[model samples]
Target chain A: MDSTIIIEKSVIIVAVFALTMLMAMYSTWAERKVAAWLQDRVGPNRAGPFGLFQPLADGLKLFSKEEFEPNTPNRFLFFVGPAIAMSTALMTSAVIPWGDRLHLFGRDILLQATDLNIGLLYFFGVVSVGVYGIMIGGWASNNKFSLIGAVRAASQMVSYEIAMGLSIIALLMMTGTLSLREISMQQAGMNWNIFYQPLSFIIFLICAFAEANRTPFDLAECETELIGGYHTEYSSMKMGFYLFAEYANMFISSTILAVLFFGGYNYPGMSWAVENWGVNIANVLGFGALFIKLCGFIFFFMWVRWTIPRFRYDQLMHLGWRILIPLAIVNIIITGTVILRADIAAYFGF
Target chain B: MSTVLIIFCVLAAITLATAFLTIFSRNPIHSAIYLVICFFSIAGHYLLLNAQFLAIVHVIVYSGAIMILFLFTIMLMNLNEEREVHRPRITRVGAIVSFCLICLVLIAIFINSKPIVGEYVTTGEDYQSIKVLGKILLNEYMVPFEFVSILLLVAMIGTVLLSKKEKLQK
Candidate 1:
């Protein structure tokens, strides 16, 4: 209720909005560049200084192009489809801890949109809502291919989210907190969780890849089969919204993976920096550390996209239910036994 | 008169309205979208409860993952408005009546309980953080945690079996 908190929250919201828009912009360029590099060809060299402005150009093109809606009976639902995708994509960033606190003008700035106690849960909830956009877009398109693509994407996402949730459970148990800020704090001064819970981290990494719907898990939009997947019938900016949402999801999920498992906003000798450089400078450095971690995960996403082949539907389901879910459960059990041994002994009167 | 109270009222109204519409909408796809709106509104309610964790889980589970399954089923079955089977008038009336009774009972129970509201305590430690939730699951609720694992396994097997079609050769 304090003015300072309100100001801090507003600043964070603005920053996250700016960050999401910027990431969505760059991801378009990045996807193209990655595709180009993989095929051993130069890409988008002319747009604006090494194709940096390609996303801008693409946006302009989409806007200029006439919006096309098929002769679907439900006009209201048709428009709602892309709006759902774009809004839900932006909503997930609400809980991401972009940085540690930075002191400015005698007021401490929290470098996140909203530091809810249930930050991870908030992320999961937002990510889940993301499905509506795709489903709506596909269903409203009134095309068989679009409908099929929607079906495929919906199934793929739901199957993988279970694995993703289970994977996080192991790390959550290890860190003993859900607030991303607290998780980041616990990972300070070289006590990164990846060292302690590598299995959980790996499973999380895989689930992250799947959740993003990148290559190998991109059955939703396989150009060969689904003809551009869920957005097949979409044209112009409506189409752009769907694609942009995908990248936004990718960027947010990457940031999450960094924060949760890779010592978000923490680095070696962070204490030394705080002691020497003061709280503001140290926190800035921590933010830089988080940014670096996020970029690494994003690059990993891109790397896997370029390298791997798509998973067959049956194979994808098999991995989710049979492999990833079970492994995640085992990881949770192991984490439980190790952390709760004392409590277990006490409970048994040992 | 508090901002919190006002926000809660708005969110609660939106949640209940959308939830009511979710079941009432003749078109299943429309019902799905309304359900999504309902989930989001519930997430807002969760925010009010200070159960940010549970709210997010609710969004992720009900809105994101579970709704996707519903969407897939709807699409795969091609249950558009044209193919949608309308409910019989008598059955529809019964459903509405039963729903009203359920709501009335729930409201009555809630009003009668007058649950003592706790003061908002800023626990220096976030007890419900994902990490803490994990710790509690492993340490305190370890048995239920294991049970959930078996539950998922059974669910997985059941889904595969249910979806499988018997071939003429078999």
Candidate 2:
């Protein structure tokens, strides 16, 4: 690669890293704020105006807290746990196309870190590996509750990942490309996949929740049962890392949901805006559109968290294995049939 | 000397060291973790070879899914207290014989295989991309692919049957 391309990519990577961190930080504040609002209370107004700096305050508190470690022999693995969680949480944003290309400095700049051809699979790989962080952390803690929580998380994530992958296969059949940029480009001007593949979208959305270990499916950390779940033995910045990773995961999954089902950076009048306005302005608007969709999904995630009760362990398993997986498979079959309808009609001489 | 060569060497060293650590580690969990690293390094090798799809799938299947299950099983077993296993002399001799025989066979195979004479040549073909890979697997390797699926299905059915039978006994 040329020096300019390298520089561009590094800048994009740093920007995305910062953006993910910002979103994750705000998501913490937003989760509490939204939860409080739903429950009819003032939430964190003491920090900055409207408690915007609450996350920062929380970070500082975590930093100042004493780093507590359980008397576990596997100290290295215990340390590796949060590091893995934090890194994997941040890694998923690499392939996401934040917006359409921008015309800057007389060069067309693609607003993504890297456009891997198998971007969807890359996302899956990173997400699947995310289980290790929890499993290792929980097991290393040498606590029965932590171990149970980790096991629950592992089974839950694994079961839902199947459904998630199947649901995306349906979308892939329509888009015929694994590149997020191409997927986003295909969804230009109100042609979102959600319109056509609504079933897949719903399946993917639910699986996204399960995968992120968000509420309703968050049996891993359901305070009533598991007592803080995998991070039961964690404290100080270590516990903070797990919490931050969860919010980061929620943010990434929300972004993925928007990018896959919703039109990503595309809006209803995107074509008109592109035709009338310049590419930079249009792309900036597209980025704003994507941001709105992702934030809306994030809010929806929190909304469901406070509203819906956590699923019973068996109920969670039943929903994933019996309901979602089969539904996702059926969605794939239906999508395939719809996509090849003309060919099938010709074959049947209809 | 070259950057690519340096990266390959680093990955190779990681792969070998992790593989050895996987075997030599006292704790089963540590072994599993090392094995996960070994799998990841192999995936890195695949990426180095420009087989991006293969690399990611390798990571997903082996390092991600399989290793998670392995760790789960190990953790559940709670094998923290190491126990010494006493193998009979004949069994130990047999194990050593088999290990050496397998190593000899692998070495012979490598020695017999044709060696590359020059720098690796790029065919400049779209062979490793997911689209082409899917086309090739469905078209040319259709029978083997279907057979593999059937094998997996059979295994799944066998597992379900075993578990169901145990439940019925209870």
Candidate 3:
């Protein structure tokens, strides 16, 4: 029985890993396609039909490119930077529940890599360490531009994270659980948290944008101003790793947003479908539903990237600290009041 | 049980080695990185105890926020070449003496605190989950919680005041 469980878990882990990579790979393609369509230009169409093989081609190019490095003293840290970035991006997928469960071989198989009790916090922890990648890479390069970019990335993340965490606290108070799976299950049958906590959702979305270093919040790599920002000194696959990590981070952030707010894997009439079609098919559909949600969120990310202009550094900080933090705190207070309304009403004889 | 013990030993080794490296590393940035690894190793120990919430929070607060800020400061100061060259040999001897004294003190504390006849018992995992931790914190530790918030408020005010530039009177 234990061995069977182990096998099932191993299979799920491989599947999740492959799926994350696949999504991230396509996200790069989709990003370019979206950008092209947005600007009234054809994008990467020369590399296989509709640029489907563009990422593969890009990968080969990056691999074949010269492994360039700045004449810096800290070569170890330079190499370690992308490794930290890639690993942290991948680590977040461990706690996220991809779907409900599968009933295979007469036993229930969990879709998550691991159902960590404090999954949300685990996600935040991984995200926090993600800063090290950019910082270490930039600093090790010993380039002024790289250093400035790393500093910007560090401060911007620090600011946005405060607001992000505060907003999540409000949601946590409402849900009363830290487990992502529990949060996902709570949003079953259209009782999405976004409906009740729209303010928090907006805060989270903005923070997600910032956290993933997406547009408007992508001051870290503002091309014209910083000349590739933190990665000005990096080249070849090391540079590719940083860029790939960003997309991976985006994928994970979208998945988190989907799970946290958008009724993850919970479509309308899902319970009915399960009753009629049995557990396996129902779960299969649920997984599909989650994929659909993830795609929608990924597309949203791309759409915003092309549409919105990047924020000035000071403006980003002001939004994160001056506006979002206060708003998130207010949200928490309001949520707390609503939660205790019954008790308050009882006391006041309402 | 043996597997858990082995894991614990590995984590302990990592934590101790990283902690030592954190202090002894020549580069300030390398020291900061070592500190982060040390923090992660400690977090691993927390996980073994099934205090998952504490483990992740430790990672977030220590490796995430604190370490990032530390790294930022180190970079901003350009402290890569921070090794002291003009320090007198006497000061180095004094530093070594102090370090040995602290080590001796820590060993004394460890030896004194260990119970003679009691086997360490597991706290059985239920207590450290976020929900229970929250309940206990809000109910029993409410005063300290409020106090901490006030302390943070004061610190924030102090930071703003300190960082803000004042206009000079003509």
| Candidate No. with top TM-score | 2
| Cα lDDT, model 1, residue A74 | 77
Taking the tens digit of each residue's C-alpha lDDT, what string does model 1 give over A1-350?
Answer: 68978877887888889988898899889878988998898989888899988899999999999887788977787788889889988998887777788878987777887777767877777677777777788888888888888777777777777888888888887766678888988888788888888888888778777777788888888889888887887789988888888888888888888888788888888889888899888888888888888878777788788888888999988988899899989999998898899688889998
Candidate 3, A25-76: lDDT as tens digits: 8899999998999999998898898989999999999999999878999999
RMSD of 1: 4.3
Best by lDDT: 2
DockQ of candidate 3 (2 decimals)? 0.81
Report model 1's chain A TM-score.
0.95
lDDT of 2 at A320: 90
lDDT of 3 by residue, B58-93 (tens): 989988898889888887876535555577899999
Mind giving the per-residue lDDT tens digits that candidate 2 earns over A1-350?
78999999999999999999999999999999999999999999999899999999999999999999999998998999999999999999999999989999999999999999999999999999999999999999989999999999998998899899998998998899999989999998788989999999899999999999988999999898889999999999999999999999999999999998898999988888888997889889999999999999999999999999888999999999999999998988898887799678989999
List runs of model 3 lying over 4 Å from the truth: A346-350, B80-125, B165-170
DockQ score, prediction 2: 0.85
Considering the two chains of model 2, state its CAPRI-style docking category. Answer: high
In model 3, residue pairs whose N, Cα or C atoms come closer than 3 Å (at least 3 residues apart or on different chains), thus clashing, are none
User: Predictions ranked by TM-score, top down?
Assistant: 2, 3, 1
- The C-alpha stretches of model 2 lying farther than 4 A from their native spots are A346-350, B80-123
Q: After superposition, how far is residue B47 of candidate 1 from its true place, in Å?
A: 3.4
Better of 1 and 2 by TM-score: 2
